[model samples]
Target: MNLISCAALAAALCISVHAAAAAPVKIVAAENFYADVARQIGGAHVQVTSILNNPDQDPHLFEASPSVGRALTHAKIVVYNGADYDPWMDKLLSASKASDRRTIVTGQLAHKQSGDNPHLWYDPSVMPLVAKELATTLEASDPPNAQDYAKNLQSFLAALKPIDARIKAIKAKYASTPVTATEPVFGYMAKALGLDMRNEHFQLSVMNDTEPSASDTAAFESDLRNHAVKLFIYNSQASDGAATRMLALAKQSGVPVLGVTETAPAGKSFQRWMLNELAAVEKALAH
Candidate 1:
């Protein structure tokens, strides 16, 4: 019990406390766009990992690995797109259970069911709900940073104003505009814009990796050849033989085509990605 020994012990204790306070909250999101939103809200207070980040890969064919399970073990918050879009996430989460882990399901937030179009993020209203929920969750988990979370939530919502405006402008100008897609990935956004989406059976068949009936296929082709729809949207990330052929036919018929992807591209924020797609839609419709 010397004076020097006591002083050294007190300094070590203080250093340990400061280090613990500075540690960032760990979050894992099934999709990168969700992760991007979490980052926008959490800022420097959180560390995020997104499993489906590759824009070139088809997300429908995604399979989880052991490392993803390991990542979940240390996470305090987990975000996922449910409603059968990422069914593999269910299995991975169930395998690694944590008492303190909080999960946010976009499908549940939007009241979407298993058979509904699982790309819930395409809906403009869905992200605001997600951002609010994320802010509330972050505040609850780390009270010290509550004010920052609330401020970030406001910024995130404000950032979405342009997107809402664009949708309103498009809907006002072109409500019920005839459009067809190779898959249902952009169905929700298209609905928001008041589009008359055609060929549901064919889109669903291609999405589920099944062959569309001869009649359904013929109808889709006829629509393209006769220029029934004003615009053709193709899921560039997950195209099959049927979708590819339809895309070619649409071009041959001189119909305007737009390419959309299921996931946000690398280095683009969720807000920028949506706005860019909207701009492209506006340009194509004017053609």
Candidate 2:
């Protein structure tokens, strides 16, 4: 009874240990774009969940649900756009205190703070930083797969070269070209491209869902009406009457309008999404 029973028990324990070690790391990102980055770097080694994935929904309006909290409870790694962009993530993390969990705040990595422009993913420098940090986190968490994580991270960084080149070319050709946006969703990218962005007060008001002062509204309209801004960008995901009116006015005045979303669309990787947006900007500026 003793010899056969001991051998079978040891074999079962060995199999259990291997299965546990082979389980994929779980990651939860507050936004889908970050999840996409996690997927790129993690590949098959991680399972990622993105809270704000719907392109049609406004991320600013996101409220965390119970399921999100449950996901956070099981997540080994968490990523979120900080600087108050997705404050709900902070609340959820605090509620579920796990000492082993690692949280990567993209805004903090970008040296952004509260009251600063929170649309940080649009910053060309931010995502590369995020990718590196994500790879490092994965390596530290799963040393057995460190080499694969490093390779994926390298590929992810290399993919950004075209995006960087696009930004450089645009900046060289269109530096200081006047542009205006209904919201600051693309503010960082616009800054990278060296475009002159106008109507800050109005954009902040719209982003915060506050009423823009009458004078600020008038100035925004005047810019569009007079073709003062070379390009007019509106937050396509979230809009109000003021934004809608400005969009129509831009069309009336023959100003080129570009729509940028706070969240990336589905079926596109982070790299592809950025490239597409950059291409659109280049197209609009050419016309």
Candidate 3:
């Protein structure tokens, strides 16, 4: 090729490379599941960061810092579990207001209020709304790659089909099964599976970080001791003293225990994480 033609091609290649690198949308999620979902929807066009990403730790105990504040301020789009689930995220957003920032609250999409269950990720319908909102926000952020974002959203939705079918299958197989928990972390999924989840007062008390009433505690203990429930679903991440005691009692009673979580486990996609947890419940129920 002629020298002039070679130089022109090299310059064009550099511009193309720079444009490709700049196409990604900056996104931040308060929790990892939402980040995973956003990543599924945004695909190669979005760069995502999650603040509460430790699957081994309780997200409710997250301590915010200056770095978190900077992340919120710098992100073009941010997602958080609202209804007081991550009030710190709200505080960060309030403090880090920007003209083009888009904030998505998963709880609000699920129509949750302050006193309502904050574990909205367990609800089947939450992420669909989140994915839609995220795609719209991402399209606006990177108009040149809007079609890619839309296509990724469709792909993510299609991928969820098997997970949804599995959930239905489990619900059908274990409809109206008796169960109990230390907290309401898996309450939505339990309801979907048609479980007669007992000890609401105790679960709510634990979730609200308060002491369960004597009657509530007695009922929980009685249920565990007598095998009144077939399964005990515990939040392994939030195992406080009461939860630890309940876990021991449940194990002693021979009722199978299923551990659920607020964060996605290490090396799991959001869909895979949920399916695995449901499979655990299924395995426990099969006995």
Candidate 4:
């Protein structure tokens, strides 16, 4: 090849490599739901690593590993649900001491406290706020692609309108329906749909890995046996024996049980996952 041809080819290759390396932002999320939202907003300009992506894994019992710490330490942006939900992540972030890293705590953004419900992602309003914060962070990190991030943020916020509508629709049709869960995994969403959540003490006991008092257990069983609740929501990822027994009782009593996961399922978006669960609840109550 001629000298001119070789020089031109090398210059083009260098530009391609530089662009590839420079075009994207690096993000690490403690949960897959936030990671999915980041992916939607960042699109092709972000690489997201979600530590808790397994639906079968109990998020309540998660422990930090060296590799996870390394990822957080090196990440340009780290997103996690705070409010004592994932305290290990806070420790990791503090240990890393990354002055420039952008951290978006969805729990804190929603005014959630340490004793409040830790599952902020399930709340419809939380992600949109997180998405907006993420867009701002991404734009600050990658000014060259700021417009793309802004457009993506708007699209994501717009997409959530349908989910909100579905929640309103469920409220219109099935509001005030009695429901209970082995854990309060769906508590926020249930409240949004106006579900009368019963057995609060039992659910909270199971959530905290403490044994439910005999009285609370009896009340839960009684609610199931008497068909007082229309739907039973189960955190399919939790491993408590009390929750398991409650599930069996729920089945035997013919109460419709719905399985919910802590993280988004593989190949599903955050909006899609929420809608799917809401659809299930609506269907169970439709009968």
Candidate 5:
């Protein structure tokens, strides 16, 4: 081939590589749970980002920062829990007006009805669906690597099977077992496993960041003293004075206490942290 022809071909190849590298898949997740899932599915192909890392802070009260706006602006795909949770993400996505960016709202999943619990990830069935949606979205954005993305997604789904099996085993062993929690953070998992919640009113009030009424507090205390509950599930991150009192009561009453946290605890992977928390509950119930 002529020198000129060879030079032109090299230039074209360089341009193609540059364009591909510049458009790597970008994902922004509203919370760490989605972030972890995205990382598992996206692997080395996508850059995943999350806004909330603090387990103690209420996501409802999150304030958007300039960096968050920049992340939203550049994301090729966004994943968030909808249903008025993380409303800031919706506002930022609307303002960005990026037509090509695909947003996956967990609340839009098939089983998620309006006013249904926004904590979809805790429901074992929901994560696979989210992973599937993420794979589809990533495939659309980077069609050249669609096969790899699908493989990654399949692996993620398979990894979750053990967790599902564990949950089933727990349900079989402790159906209708009574448990109490300071808030609704563990409600989805508990309900899915058929555990009876003994203090619904108190949980709802605390989950909404409000003070439980006198009647609700009295009922919760009565249940604890009467030994109506086998275990006390507390969100270690969001513990308050009332929750502290409940924990003490549980210890005093010989009811085992299980400490749970919303975000992934310090050194543990997301899956390990979650399973460990549930295992602690199982241990408490068995004692």
Candidate 6:
């Protein structure tokens, strides 16, 4: 082989290495929760992006913009809650026709079909599964950094162990404790903590953003007046007039209120925000 041929081969190899190192794996997360998990598992190898980050807006009613479509079109992997919660992503994915892109749907992970609750992230068991799946998918997409991806997944799972332990402790401490909420957003977490929830009708109605019937409202008011629930979990994102009224009634009855956010609020890390919310619930129960 000539010297020039050897130099050309070396340059090509260097170019290939540089390309692999410079190219970031693009990930599109339909919700903020998935975005957080993706970041934890992907670390510096993946660029995780989320469409829904507004704590004040209802995720169910989210409308996709041109930028979202473009993101979906270019994403190497996508994560979404599939129980008709982020149906906009479904439409965008279908329209974009990116068959090669890997997609993970949390509802499918839970074996739930349409109309089922889409808030799967609140379940303590879901995050590890999602992280593992994400790591696997990222490994498949970018084989050059498979070891890094695995290491990140292991670190994230290790960190999550204590969070799960904390949840179990709360459950043991508050077994069968009575709680109430304006919406079913926190039902999974509450159930995991073994908190018995009252005012289901009001929760479901508010969750669907439909007006509660007169009888349902009256029943919820009676429950509040009678102090039927020890703690009131208020959804800060979509608090309707009914929820506001319920909050007032809970205050009058001396029931402690724990405010919950549907999305990670401004200036808070995902795990910190969740821990803070759970701590608030614990405080309310303690009081």
Number of clashes in every candidate structure?
0, 0, 0, 0, 0, 0
TM-score, structure 4 vs. true: 0.92
Better-scoring candidate (lDDT), 2 or 6: 2
Q: Write the per-residue lDDT of candidate 6 for residues 63-94, one digit (tens) a residue.
A: 88999999988899999888877777778998
- Residue range with the least summed lDDT across 10 consecutive positions in model 3: 17-26
Q: Write the per-residue lDDT of candidate 4 for residues 75-130, one digit (tens) a residue.
A: 99999999888889878888898888989998878988777878887788788899
Better of 2 and 3 by TM-score: 2
Q: Between prediction 1 and prediction 5, which has the larger lDDT?
A: 1
Which portions of model 6 show Cα errors greater than 4 Å?
1-13
Instruction: Give lDDT for model 2.
Output: 0.93
Q: Which residues of candidate 2, in runs, are more than 4 Å off? A: none
Off by over 4 Å in 5: 1-15, 18-23, 110-115
What are the TM-scores, per candidate, against the unseen true structure? 0.97, 0.96, 0.92, 0.92, 0.90, 0.93
Q: For candidate 3, what is the lDDT?
A: 0.88
For candidate 1, the C-alpha RMSD (Å) to the true structure equals 1.2
Residue 254 CA displacement from its true place in model 2, Å: 1.4
> What local distance difference test score does each model get?
0.94, 0.93, 0.88, 0.90, 0.83, 0.84
lDDT of 1 by residue, 160-223 (tens): 9999999999999999999999989899999999999999999999988899999999999999
Candidate 4: clashing residue pairs, number: 0
